[model samples]
Target: MPDTGRSERGAVSAARTRDFARFRHEALLLKALGISKPLIACMAQRAAVTGTSIETEVLASGAIDEEAYYGGLARMAGLPFVAEIPDGMINDGPALDCQLKEPTLVRLHCNGRAPVIALVPKITHIEGLASRVKRSACLGETIVITTPSAIRRAVWKAGGERRGRVAVHGLFQATQPLSARTVVTGDQGFSAGLLISGLLMLLALAPQLLMIILHLILSLFHLGGLMLRLAVLAHTRRHGSEHETMLQSADMALPIYSVMVAIYREAAVVPQLIAALDEIDWPRSRLDIKLVCEADDLETLAAIAKVRPGPHFEVVEVPAMQPRTKPKALTYALAGARGEFITIYDAEDRPHPQQLREAYHRFRLSSDKLACLQSPLVIANGGESWLSAVFALEYAALFRRLLPALGFYRMPLPLGGTSNHFRTAALTGCGG
Candidate 1:
């Protein structure tokens, strides 16, 4: 009690020593394993520049062999190393019953009573999970190191075994939808077909009268819709305001933000997408960026790999299925999102850096009913073409005017495909 300050100082000093010791230990292990000093220095430099773990950067940047890294990790952890995980080594019961493939950062080996985990060396919370997995699985966890690709294969296999081949299918399929929900329904198609058939029959029976009445009704409906849209635009132009003052301070702790980007054949835009994500104001640690790609889109996937996104980014490969739309890709990506808030961006989107912060603050200040935030969409190349200019104007009216008016009136919002931030729970509750 008399020397509490001295004790605290000593504890801090010891913690620093332990941290340095781990670094030195890894370096010595690499050297002892015959890794070159220059390569070791390169790993350290890349880790420093990318804000990723030394082990991960070394592996990703090709400075170290994957097998060597795993072996070295096993030695450092004092655990047995396996060059290859055997077939059925992970018991289907425990693996299927648990979320082994999720988070895309950890892989679970369920062969024994104890769970073996291959986790990202830097990002994984070994201390916190030690008790949790043991309590949940009724087995102690054995931690190891593995690359992201290894875990992806494990997850895909486990899911297929557990949920059938459709487990890997994106949320939408023509044969069977994911749940009670569907992005498009047969009922809608049937109804549309019925309406067209009835209209044709009417035209055949009494063309003159039916055409006149149909035109009148359609014209009125169109006029009313345009008037309502104009009204919203007028209101927006008069009172639209930014939540500039509501922005949080930079010192405030940032919550995890999930960003979903779906790319099919967009190889050329992959670099731009990465650049746009990097430009976000939020810390990389707090940004969970999922680049959703189709399994068959090898070109786009290759482009993404060439970009070499940092630890914050993940590549979610959606198994090819019917109704191959962006929403389908997003639905697949949604299953693995780990964040408090989620948002979407297109292949060419370049949202403001402060967008995430503003959205977070707006949600905090808003009522519980306010579950989503729509960012304004602006076209940067409107001057280049007449069609582009028209598209730009339409977007301006839709995002700025109509959406704001709809929000103000508490009316149902027709959500735009991208830049719409949502509360994660709310989205998942509605079968994201």
Candidate 2:
């Protein structure tokens, strides 16, 4: 039998053909919108370098707003453009979640007139859609056009209740122990109380002995911790450079890397945040960047929408549930993640461009046991103050020395919150 581990040459050729078609369609779109040839050429080169689509480069380059560009297509196709789709007109459910990932079409149900499909009409299919409308006059009743954002908004409204419930309680329902729904388990609380009471009694009855015993226990605990950190640091220093070259370039078929940022009351951080994220060296088409915001954080949400991000960017709204924490927001949007690898970043984080590629390469080389990789977190503005200097040094020691050391010893690594790369399976298997 032939090998099934990889695509055959014919399959590869067909995929390349599709890429050409995508580029051609995007070129048509650019030309119709009066985009200059020089800019188009520049975008094409950037797309080639990144292994992304021309549309992606154009969108990321900020040459034009996403809605305005789509509106240009609507005008060219002779279809009406809708800035927003009313909630009641569109039926939505969890099944329609695919639309959320790659928003293309939505069926609208009106009161009096015939039902119309609101599509983010592709330039490649403009003629095809128009021909069908021509053949069946009633079909042309209204194949109205809308932006991806509008389609996303309508879908979010349609599946609010179900999606919100899943976001809030899906992990708990799947695996209660893995969830922090109940911060302290009943058994743990009882044990803690018993220990506290015993400690108090000992302290009161035999102060000198209790002090000596407690001091030894505390000292050993810390000593062990320090020894472990130091051991890991030394081990890493020995073999860290062995695979550095191998991790420079990732595999040809790069999996989608989901980058999720949980934003709350950081409206002012949006511009720089987006800019920093865009600096990541990855194909925009295969990147699923979710700017997850709480439902009540309208300011940040509005700021994100105002930017008019490309199709690759999604604005995931987490329900304002109890324990409105960053973890909760991230977990809420986990259901919509469409990547094989997932990573989280803070609004202020500016990760190195090759960080994803480096992590991905290491993951592929390592066995299945290698589930996660933490990118080093460095503070660039450490010279600002004494507090900043200490923070920077702490980060350098923890991320650069301790984390690698722990990994070298094959011990559990406490992942650095930002710039962490993880296998999607590992993440979801542990209840997301």
Please provide TM-scores, in order, for all candidate models, with all chains considered together. 0.68, 0.81
Clash tally for model 2: 1
| Structural RMSD, model 1 | 8.1
176-225 in candidate 2: lDDT tens per residue? 89776779999999999999999899999999999999999999999998
Poorest 10 consecutive residues of model 2 by lDDT? 243-252
Candidate 1, overall lDDT? 0.69
Model 1 misplacement above 4 A: 1-73, 81-153, 160-208, 237-243
Model 2 CA lDDT for position 355? 83
Q: After superposition, how far is residue 78 of candidate 2 from its true place, in Å?
A: 5.2
In Å, residue 386's CA in model 1 sits off its true spot by: 1.6
RMSD of each: 8.1, 5.6
- The candidate that wins on TM-score is 2
Pairing residues by index, what is the TM-score of model 2? 0.81
